[model samples]
Structures are given as C-alpha cells and as structure tokens.
Target: MSCKVIDTHSQLAYVVRMIHCVCNNINTAKVDAAAARGAESAACVQRACGTKFNCGQCREDINHRLAAWRALNPMLEAAE
Candidate 1:
C-alpha cells in the first residue's frame, strides 16, 4: 500500500453539500449573500427560506464549516 500523509492541524472548509435546512432553504451561499445584503441573523434566513433546522447532524458540521469559511474570509461575521 502507498503511504499518504496530510496535516491534520490545518483547518479547511469543505462545502460538500448545500445546507438546505428544510424549515428554511438556507444553503451555504445564502449566508454570504445575506451578509452582502446586510443580514446578520440566521432567523432572517429562516424567515426567507424556511431553513429553521431539523435533525441537526449537519448543524455542528455547518457551524464548524462556517467558522472555517469565516476564518478564510475574515471580513464577514458568521451568520450561524
């Protein structure tokens, strides 16, 4: 077998899927779009798209991804 190595300490945002909270259609891009449009609340997304959240398996991952994404794009505060 070939050996492969990756640096785990380094963080990255892997937006594997668009986060469409069924209660709201809040996808990954919406957060940025919302911020661009001057929205700071996840609820605003909920109000707009019904992405209020459900099972939450994705919640922790979403939060972490949002943080990772934000770290890379530091000018925007995460709307999570």
Candidate 2:
C-alpha cells in the first residue's frame, strides 16, 4: 500500500486571496494579473481591473502589490 500526505496549510497560503482594494473589490490575484499585463502604476492596475480609486486608501497597497509583482518578474522591469 502507498500513502500520500498533503500539506493543506502551505497550499492554502498560496491559494489564499487577499482583498487589496475594498472600494473596488480588487484582490491580489487581480493586481498581479494586471501587473503581468503591463500595469506599471496603480492607476494602470485599477484600469486593467475595470475599476477606479474611490476612497484612495488602497493606492499604497496597490503600489506595494505592483512592486512585489515587479520583483517577481524581473524581466518585465528590465524591459521597462
């Protein structure tokens, strides 16, 4: 017999979706997708996500997400 074990905790961490923009219901996945699609600024990310800043509190978080995305995608940053 063979047994397999799954690390749900670690797997859940990767699958977890964080709400970065409460005003527009934007999540980290959306932000990353926008970044992957050439969104260099928060405004670009908002536009790509089909929404705009309302309260504006999420701007900084969006920027952070963009920065993290850029870090992961160094080639995109180098090309820019």
Candidate 3:
C-alpha cells in the first residue's frame, strides 16, 4: 500500500512549499521569498537563495513558484 501527502497550500502535488531542490535543500518558500523581493527570474531566485543547479530538475518548479508568488503578492510592491 502507498500513501500520498497533500500540502495545505494547494491540492496539486507541485505546491511551492514542497522541496524543489534537494541538492541545496531549497523549498518553494525560499523561492517565493526571493520572488516577493523582486527576483524576476529563476536564476534570480537561485542567486537570492544561494543555490546552484545540480540535476536541473528544479528550474521549472522554481519558475512556477515564482509566477505564483508574484500573483499572490501583487500588492506587495505598493506597500513598499
């Protein structure tokens, strides 16, 4: 038998809080933080989080999280 965990942030398995880069122990929260701070691209997120590409598996996931973060915090800039 097998069981799967669901994150409260999303019904989808790809929620950003899930680990995105095992190589650097980077999760969606870190990526989203970077995006919230104006890191516009995946490379920016990587740089902000002090992580590097290892297996290249996380690039797409990071990008997805970045977009979501931007959408969630669109008003963040106005408060700054």
Candidate 4:
C-alpha cells in the first residue's frame, strides 16, 4: 500500500481580522493594516498577523480598506 501525505503551508493558514463592509464577511481592518505595512506585497502583514490572502476576490475592498486604515492611523504612518 502506498500513501501520499499533503502538508498545509504555514503561510496559507492565516485568518485576518476583517469586518464585512458589505456584510459579506470581509475583514477590512486587517487588510488595511497589512496594506499599510506591506502595500502591494502584504507578505509582511501576512507573516506577522498570520492572515492569508484568502480574499483575493476582494482586492477592491482591500484597497479601500487600506486607504481608510491609513487615514485612521496617521500617527502610525508618521512613525513609520
């Protein structure tokens, strides 16, 4: 008998703290923070927060969320 085993990547098992802006269960807060930290990359936030890009379909919303978050976190931006 032969058995094949599959492992889940640590990077992929991330759940961001998102709020459903459209009531579609989309986490915006997390996306925004991640974007501010990494922008297009988002990898840094992904690693730190363990939030996978599961919502690729929500790119537009993500962008919007990022902008809103930046506006809210002006001090964070200046510090960075």
- TM-scores of the models, in the order given: 0.42, 0.74, 0.70, 0.43
**For candidate 2, lDDT tens digit of each residue in 1-80?**
99998766744533568999999999989988998889988899899988989999999988988887787779977886
The stretch of ten residues in a row with the least summed lDDT in candidate 3 is 8-17
lDDT of 3 by residue, 1-80 (tens): 89998767553433525887888888877887887788877778888988778787888888887777766667885566
lDDT of 4 by residue, 1-80 (tens): 99987776533323445563333344655566566675643344444356555645554655555666666667887777
Clashing pairs in 4: 18-27, 19-27, 19-28
lDDT at residue 12 of model 3 (Cα atoms) = 46
Cα RMSD, each candidate: 6.4, 5.4, 7.7, 13.9
Question: Global lDDT for candidate 3?
Answer: 0.76
Candidate 1 residue-wise lDDT, 1-80, digit = tens = 99999787453333434664544456677654554454435555444454565664544544554455556665655443
Model 2 per-residue lDDT at 47: 98
Q: After TM-score superposition, what is the CA distance of residue 65 in candidate 2 from its true location, in Å?
A: 0.6
Candidate 3's error at 4, in angstroms?
29
How many residue pairs clash in each candidate at the backbone level? 6, 0, 0, 3
The residue ranges of model 3 lying beyond 4 angstroms of the native Cα positions read: 1-16, 77-80
lDDT of 4: 0.54
Candidates in descending lDDT order: 2, 3, 4, 1
In TM-score terms, which candidate is top?
Answer: 2
Worst 10 residues of 4 by lDDT: 9-18
Best model per lDDT: 2
Candidate 4 lands at a TM-score of 0.43
Candidates ranked by TM-score: 2, 3, 4, 1
Poorly placed runs, candidate 2 (over 4 Å): 1-16
